[model samples]
Target: MISSIFFYSTAFVLFLIGLFGVLTRKNIIKILVSLSITETAVNLFLVTVGYIKNGKAPILTNTIGSIGMNNLKFVDPLPQALVLTAIVIGLGTTALSLVIAIKLYKNYGTLNITKMGGKR
Candidate 1:
């Protein structure tokens, strides 16, 4: 119970920190980094949500017979799969955003958002 609370609270704090950074930062790179941080926090939260305390892996072995009506505790796997997908998507997005930022920097001769608007 306590561990779950800790995991959830930590993930929430990381999300808030990332949100603050995204809102307050002026640099495109900083914003991208904050976005990645937010993605990480969300992934962490999702994994935590699927966690089952004192639970075993969702695997059945030959020795473990009589699967029916047995008190077998297995951790949920859906959230883990979802988080993996989100991570891949996040990586693609971050890479694309960085490529755009590089192009903007080359065109405007600056990485600052405010400075980029003045000349280009």
Candidate 2:
């Protein structure tokens, strides 16, 4: 019970911190890092949500002899699968953003958005 609460709270706090960083930071690289942090928080939250106390993996084994699925306590797999996909997508997005940031830096010679905009 306590562990569950802690996991959820930690995920929420991480997400909030990432959001704050993205909203307040001016450097493109910092913003990309913030976005990755947000992705991590989301993935953690999803995995946490799928957790079951004292539950076994979603797999079948001979140990469970004649007992059927109705009697077994197995952790949900959907959230885990979704999180895996999300992780891959997040990696791709982060890579793309990094490439774009590199292009922007090469063009403007600065990673700061405001500075790139010709502002003082």
Candidate 3:
């Protein structure tokens, strides 16, 4: 199986790429997309944080019979639950931001952030 380090590195790279896109891109829609990427990276990182090697689900089963707490190797569920909640919130925020972007485009006739307000 793949190690948690791989997941962590992947998440870090995604976050960096997203940050670069947000910082360097001029279009409002692209920035929103980058923000979504960053959100996804964060979610991935959170999930990775809860990983446990050789861990089983927290649920007790008859198949794993008579296992004591000291021998239990259940992976953490809190981070997974938090990531789920974050995903929902991120979806809502992304939709709201996209709607705002549409309104901005309608008003300015352009999606370029620098051009929206005319010459500086």
Question: What digit string (tens of lDDT, one per residue) describes model 2 on residues 61-99?
Answer: 988646876788888999999999999999999999999
Alpha-carbon TM-score of each model against the true structure: 0.89, 0.89, 0.89
Candidate 2 or 1, higher lDDT: 2
Judged by lDDT against the true structure, how good is candidate 1? Answer: 0.88
The lDDT per prediction is: 0.88, 0.91, 0.92
What is the alpha-carbon lDDT for the whole of candidate 3?
0.92
Candidate order (lDDT)? 3, 2, 1
lDDT of 3 by residue, 3-118 (tens): 99999999999999999999999999899999999999999999889989999987888866677678889889999999999999999999999999998888888999988776
Q: Model 1: runs farther than 4 Å from truth?
A: 63-69
TM-score of 2: 0.89
Stretch of 10 with least lDDT, candidate 1: 61-70
Q: What is the lDDT of residue 44 in candidate 2?
A: 91
